[model samples]
Target: MKKKFKILIADRNPHVREFLRREMAGPGYRVRLAENGREVLKFIYGDEFVDLLILDPDLPDTDAPALLRKLQNRLPYIPVVLHTFIADLGHCPDIFNVVAVVEKGGSSVERLKTVVYEILAKDRAKEKIRNNMQSAGQKKAAPATGGKDEQK
Candidate 1:
């Protein structure tokens, strides 16, 4: 069965969060909403199965960059996509924890979906490769660890 990935939308604006929730949620994706950076961290730091995070560059509480950085440091496995209307700060938030930075209001919601999928798709690809490698390593070690016992 195909794995369903959990995605988090963290935006201060209710309308924006709702828009993103509607766009990103559907079959094969478990969507969660967070109103601010603190909430986002709260949801993430726990045992949530979130794999992708979409962050608002302009948040209400703490600075977005710092929040993103802390997220990235704590959970490097999850890919973060930053959204904003500001062109200057739109530069890649790679310094913090953002994997991709996208500009808002340039295109329609459909376009944002496309951009978001593109970024997350890249991350999923990398994750697949990592998983495959780990699987191979486990296979190689299985004989060494249990082969003698099984033979006996």
Candidate 2:
């Protein structure tokens, strides 16, 4: 069986949070909300687990890049998608560590959905590989330890 793909939407606006949660929930992703930078870190450190983060750069407590650095401790393996209205002539870098930086506008929903789907797909594939490796290791060790009862 597969576990649900968890998504954390970290933004201060109530309407945005609710809307994002609703949109993300449509595709079997377990969506969570964080009202500010502090709350986002709290949820990241918690055991609830998050596979992808959709971060608004101009958050209430902190800016996007700083929050991304802070969140690295708890979700180092997870990919972040920067969601903001900071699109400008040269605001975007040629390459970024973030999987995607989406511009917030009328068509933002479709853009976000695309990035979310890509991130989830990659995360699931990595998780499956890890699980398979663990399974293979257990199987190999089971016989070396003289069967289940002895190993247990």
Candidate 3:
């Protein structure tokens, strides 16, 4: 059986969180919610692995840029989709790691859905390549002694 990808949605508004959680929930993805930066951090540090993050830059507890930096430090490989009112993130170099910057406006939810699908597709491609490389490595390492006793 295939495992579902886990996504963390971090927004200050409960409605927004619920909306996203509902939107992102489906057969291929598992959605998690966080109302603030602290909860987001806790979720990240938890045992459950997160595959993606949908973050709102207007978080009440902490600066979004700082949170992005912290997330990068902790889980650099996880892709982030920054959903915010402020679309001009060109000044924030730290947010360069974000795979998508979605403006919070009419039709934004649809846009977010599209971007999530695109990002998850890319992630799956990368995972496949990584797994192939690992399997190849294991195959090469398996014959260290030729699986037989040395010649007499």
Strongest candidate by lDDT? 3
For residues 1-152, could you state the per-residue lDDT of candidate 3 as single tens digits? 65689999998899999989988899899999889989988976778879999988777788778888888888889999988877445545578469888999888999999999999988888888999999999998875564567665
lDDT of 2 by residue, 94-131 (tens): 32347888888998988899889988888789889999
**Residue pairs in candidate 3 whose N, alpha carbon or C atoms collide under 3 angstroms:** none
Give lDDT tens digits, candidate 1, residues 1-152: 66777888888899989988988887778889999878887976788858788877677776776776777678877777767765647443445556666677846567667766776677678879999999999898875546556655
TM-score of each: 0.77, 0.80, 0.85
Query: Which stretches in model 1 have alpha-carbon errors above 4 Å?
Result: 87-94, 106-108, 134-152
Which of 2 and 3 is the better model by lDDT?
3
Q: TM-score: which is higher, 1 or 2?
A: 2
Error of 2 at 36 (Å): 1.2
Error of 3 at 53 (Å): 0.7
How many clashes in each structure?
A: 0, 0, 0
Query: If ranked by TM-score, best first, what sequence of candidates would result?
Result: 3, 2, 1
lDDT of each: 0.75, 0.77, 0.86
